[model samples]
Target: MPRIPRTKSKTGLYHVMIRGNEKKNIFRDSEDKDRFLEILYYKRQNGEFTLLAFCLMDNHVHLAIGEGTNDIAKVMKKITVSYVYYFNKKYKRVGHLFQDRFKSQVIESDSYLLSLIRYIHYNPIKSGLVNTVGEYRWSSYNSYITEKSNFPNLIDKQIIFMMLSNDPQKAKQLFIDYMSKETQENFMDLTAEENVIDEKAARLLYMNMLEEKKYKFIDPIPLNILQEVVSQLQAVTGLSIRQIAFITGINKNKVSRILRKHSKLQGD
Candidate 1:
């Protein structure tokens, strides 16, 4: 099945995620994480990308960045390839280090931009790896709050600062307060949307699975049962089979076959 091409962002900003192969640990130690960050800074200096926010996890990395001269894909390719080469050389191993392709979402609005930054910065805390975002040394939260110049990483702080307060000190205080808050209703809401999308994709795949199993008869199925299944799937995922198949590389004909078979079973 052909993979659906990802949509590029017109504004050049994206929320990107790259995971280790099979969700294995990506960072072996502080050196691995530091090397990745160093590569990121090098790329930024060469005008390949602009780092907004980032979080390095054991198995995955999240980044909020603006594409510079290079597109998001190109930027990611360069970063990952360089890091993978270094990692393999260091660990005395070979082959791919990252998963098939990185996941990305175009930031379409200011609200989402801020939310994504917070989400990325707070990943360690949210994953139960840390007690607080500020305590996560690998993330950009320290730089943002402390105004530390050690990293030389570029971040658009004015937007978030303004959202907090007009006064710089007050803005910093507010930003800290906001991040330190234990509640994550906003983050959970955003995650729910992704869950819905995943559920829909899974249901479509299940239909494809049925077709692969080759259920004997596909005709004379009851419409009501088929409709109920599809409806339940839609309610959970908010996507139609067409959309799911398009994204997931499932055959539309196979999906139809499964639906038809289920319909007949319900009728009987």
Candidate 2:
């Protein structure tokens, strides 16, 4: 089937998300985050896109960007390509870093725009990274409240603030209130909605083994049971042979042999 076209933002504003493939950790450390921010700042200059708000999570990212001289796709392409190169080179890995087709929701209304900004800023809090929004170090939350961020990268806060009120102090207070209000669409809930983990078979198989006095389908597992246990565990948990060996106290080569047999039978 053909792909559906992306919705255009009338106000030239879009709420965008890009995630790691298979929900893998994208920002492994503070250095990675800083490197990504540097890329964003450099790319922002090239693309001329206005960075409204952003939050960098461990496995994914949320960005609120205003339409600039370049199209959103092109801007994202530049960022993704450059960052993936840097990331792969640093980690000594390859292939796609981000999932295909970055998800986006158009910001058409004043209310939705305001709400979306708050949601993006509060992502770290929703993920339980910190109790309060002010405590999170990776989000643009501070830039909105403070004069300037400690980082070299900058956020365009004037547009959102000016929308609230002409009076600077009152606008700041209003923004604070709006940001701190009770929220429903948090980072955790949204990511969970998108991530569909396949654990049904694993759960059923584990339960059946437990019925037979097998604690975890390991330790003196007969040849008959070895295939079943290893197969189900691989399907359910996506564990590597080494991990299974560690968990089961079985030799790594033995675990590999069982896994190989299971794959061969399935292939046939």
Give residue 185's error in model 1 in angstroms: 5.7
User: Where's the lowest-lDDT run of ten residues in candidate 2?
Assistant: 192-201
Tens digits of per-residue lDDT for model 1, 1-268: 7876776776788878888887788899999999998998888889887787888888888888899999989999999999999999999999889988887777654445655676787788768888878778888888787756446345657656786569999888767765564433232222222311223235344455435445211222244544454444444565665644433233456445655665586699
**How do the residues 33-151 of candidate 2 rate in per-residue lDDT, one tens digit apiece?**
98888888877776569898889999888888887888888888888888899999999998988877787766654545666677787787767889888788888888888866655
Q: How close is candidate 1 to the true structure, as a TM-score?
A: 0.66
Best by lDDT: 2
Candidates' C-alpha lDDT: 0.68, 0.72
Total backbone clashes of model 1?
4
Question: Which segments of candidate 1 are over 4 A away from where they belong?
Answer: 149-154, 162-167, 183-268
How big is the positional error of residue 38 in model 1, measured in Å on the Cα after superposition? 0.1
Deviation from native of the Cα of residue 219 in model 1, angstroms: 57
TM values, all candidates: 0.66, 0.68
In model 1, pairs of residues that clash are 221-263, 221-264, 222-263, 222-264
